[model samples]
Every structure is written in structure tokens, then in C-alpha cells.
Target: MKADYKNWMPKGMVTGTGCGTIASLVLFLILGVSPIVPEGSAKKVIGIVLLILTVIFCASTIWMYLMYRAFSYNGKRQMSKQIIEGVASYVSIPDGGKGLDVGCGSGALTIACAKKNPGASFTGIDRWGKEYASFSKKLCESNSEAEGVSNTSFMQGDACKLPFEDETFDAVTSNYVYHNIPSSDRQAILLETLRTLKKGGTFVIHDIMSKVKYGDMQAFVQKLKNMGYDDVKLIDTTSGMFMNKWESTWMGLSGSAILLGRK
Candidate 1:
């Protein structure tokens, strides 16, 4: 995509950097006795202008930093709260349930579930795509440790061909991962996830359907239902706080929907 240079930079940083650079250049003129600001009252006016610009730059930088913190950590951001909720809802551990998080970037969802379900053990598997530096495996491990969740472990694995025994996990969750897969291989990934789930277990798939015709969603839902899933539910709860929490462009194009079923 082409860059929108003006708005592309966060307002705070842009204003700060632009103002600071201009101010520094102007300051040099003042010190060097350049003709730009001749020695009289004009120098005062230029100094005030520089001061105002400096303030703008500082404020903008702070605003940009706050925005970054709310959405993501390091460089990876949270998925929409609605999608997180959808995944969490399907992840059940009555006393104890073995859990698997496929495509678990940064281990945010994995760690959270592990903390909440103290009785359950959670495993997060991800290839840690290189789109962002925050997707590093070390970051996930550190995040898990920081959250103080011992039951969660991070591992690198292929989503389309998971390395696990069939019926290994009581609950499985995937968030916005399948859409990135080659369309032909998405089903294979879904089947692999299904294979690892125990009978009567819950599975949650949260992803965007903007690229395909609406009919395609119906067919996909039907396919899951045909696979012996007890109930298939689609829900759109992506708005407000949930929308602002993620950097995903999919949230902007269309809200996320959760496809949940039982094996």
C-alpha cells in the first residue's frame, strides 16, 4: 500500500520531530546571526514560535507512546477484545482441561487463559511471523514469565500440520490466523486443529470474512457442522473498545465474527 506521509506518522511524533528540527535550524540562525532573524524584536517572536513548536512536538511524542502501549507490547498488539472473548469463551477447563492455542502470537491469549484457569495447562504454538519484531519467541516466553503463569508453555509449530497426538487437547483456540494461510491450506489447518481436540471438546475460530462472498461463510459453517460439531455459532462483537485495542486492518474493514463448535 502507498504511504500517506502526512497522517502516516503518529500526530505526536510528526509534530514533535518536525517542530524540533525546524526549531533547531532556526536556533542555529539566531546563534550564527543569520539574516533570517535580524537582531531586534523579531528574534523574540521567532523564539516564541520555536517554543510553541517544541511544546507541540513533546506532546505529540507522548500521545504516540500512549497509543502504542494500549494496543501492543514491544511491537505486537492485542487482537480485538471481542475476538479474545470469543476465544476465551470456548476455552473451558472444568477443574482441568488441556488447552492449545494455535497461532498464538506473543502468547497474550495463552497466558491470560492459563492464569484464569489455574487448574488447566495451556500450550501456545506459533511460527511467530516476522511481520513484527514483537512476535519473537523470546518475547512470548518472557511475557508468560511476567504474567506468572506456570501452566503455559510456548512452542514453534506449523499450524497446517500440528505435531501432536489426536485428541490431545480438551479445548483449542485460533484467532485471525486462518485468513493468512493459503486459501487451499486453510482447511488443512482447520482439520489439523480439529484432529487435536478431544471428543465433545470446544473449538473457537475467530477470523475475518471480508475477502470472500458472504455465501462462503455459510458453506464453511455448514462444513464444520457436518464434521460432527454440536452447535455452530457466529457472532459479531467488534466495536468500541475492542476495535481500538488491535492494529489489525481487518477490524477496520469489517468486524470479526467467532465461529464456535463442539467436537
Candidate 2:
């Protein structure tokens, strides 16, 4: 069965755009009324300020709308899905081996991997937070059923502290999730994710890895090398190949990168 992959953009993520559009239009209309005010007065200055604000908000609305279209179009085009799949391709999961998808939002990445590796079983975990109200374990299960993926399951869990025991999964993956976590110890979360993998297991973790958010990722990669990790590399996803810089910056996808390695 072909998977009817749902749009990955969460409702809350687009609320700002909607609000900006409405606010800009409303302000523009109100200012068009030309409220009674003396010429060259403070009120005129206020009007100019409001007009400037309207322009800024209007521009924001347009930019955000384009971003929404990009995300939706990419979803339909399977661009991001392919990117995730590309990252997963580096890993070699044994047939019928267990795999885990951390923070599997709406089960898209999990389902993709499950479809790619039919011989493997996959477990997806997410908190189902209110911010992404449309995503729940039920929705994930339904999507898997629609995709005809029988070897996959969904559960509630945290990325920072996975509920599974050490070396429980032969492979692990996540995408665009870690940065959302409001923690100073982002690297620690990555380490925690690796802890769930069996020795020599594979992992592909993708996220916005701007230096501001993830300090010294190269150093972190070196540390992994020191720990005997093999083929550890960081691939930038925001340049020309996957997504251009403009789109990435507008969609908050800038500095996106995938960290691939074997334990």
C-alpha cells in the first residue's frame, strides 16, 4: 500500500504567519481611513510608524507564506523525505533488526525508513505535545497502516531520555527535532540517543546545527572519533543541493545538517 504521507508542518508553526497577515491587513485598512488628525502633527508621525510597521508585517506574511508553500511542496515532492532516506542509506541495519526513530513527528521519517528497510522492524516515539496537535500515536499508526507498513510501532517517549535500555536497537534516527528541545545540553541528548544503539549500530540524526545552537560540532565529531566511532561526518543540508540559503533562513531550516555515524 502506498503511504499517504501527511503534511509535516504543524499548525502552531504557521500561526505566526497567519497572525502577521491578519495584523498587517487590519492595520493597513485602519490607516486607509485617514483618521482625523492635524497635518505635520505627532499623529502624522504615528501614522507613518504604523505604515512602516504594516509594510514590515506584510513582508513577513509573504515570506512566511512562501515558506509554508516550500514545506508543503517539498512534502508532496518528497524532497525532505528523500534527504532523510539518503541519510539512512549510510546505515546498514541487519534484516529483521530493530530500529528506533526518536521524536518521530507524525511518523513520516519512521514510515519512510520502515518502507525502505522492509526486513526491519521500527519503533517510533514522540511526546505528542499540544504544539503539534495533529500528531499523535493514533495518527502515526494510521499513517503506517495506510502506508502498509506492518512492522512499525509508535509510542510516547522523550528524546533527552529514551525509555529503552542501552543497545536495544540496531539502528536509530531522528530529523529536525533536537533543536526544539529547550536545553543547554544538546550534545548530551545526542549522546543519549547513541546510548540506545547496539555496538556497531548505525545512526542518522539531522537538525539545525548552527554554531550558536550547537557549539563546536566539529569538535564534537572529533570527540566521537576519539571514542572509536567510524565514518562520522556532518553533511550540510542548507546549501545549494538540498535547499538554498534563502529558503532555509525563511523557514528556520538554516544550518541544517545530518550527523551520520556507526557506533
In order of appearance, the predictions have TM-scores of 0.65, 0.86
How much lDDT does candidate 2 score? 0.80
Error of 2 at 218 (Å): 0.7
Candidate 2 clash figure, as a count: 0
Q: What RMSD does each model have against the real structure?
A: 10.0, 2.7
Backbone collision count in every prediction? 2, 0
Output the TM-score of candidate 2: 0.86
59-104 in candidate 2: lDDT tens per residue? 7667655655555624454455666666667555779799999988
- Residue 116 Cα positional deviation in candidate 1, in Å, after optimal superposition: 2.1
Please report the candidate that would top lDDT against the real structure.
2
Can you write out model 1's per-residue Cα lDDT over 68-174, one digit (the tens) per residue? 44443223443333345546855777667889999887776787678768899999998975543346567677777776768988899989889999999988888
- What candidate 1 gets wrong by more than 4 Å, as runs, is 1-70, 73-86, 211-215, 239-241, 244-255
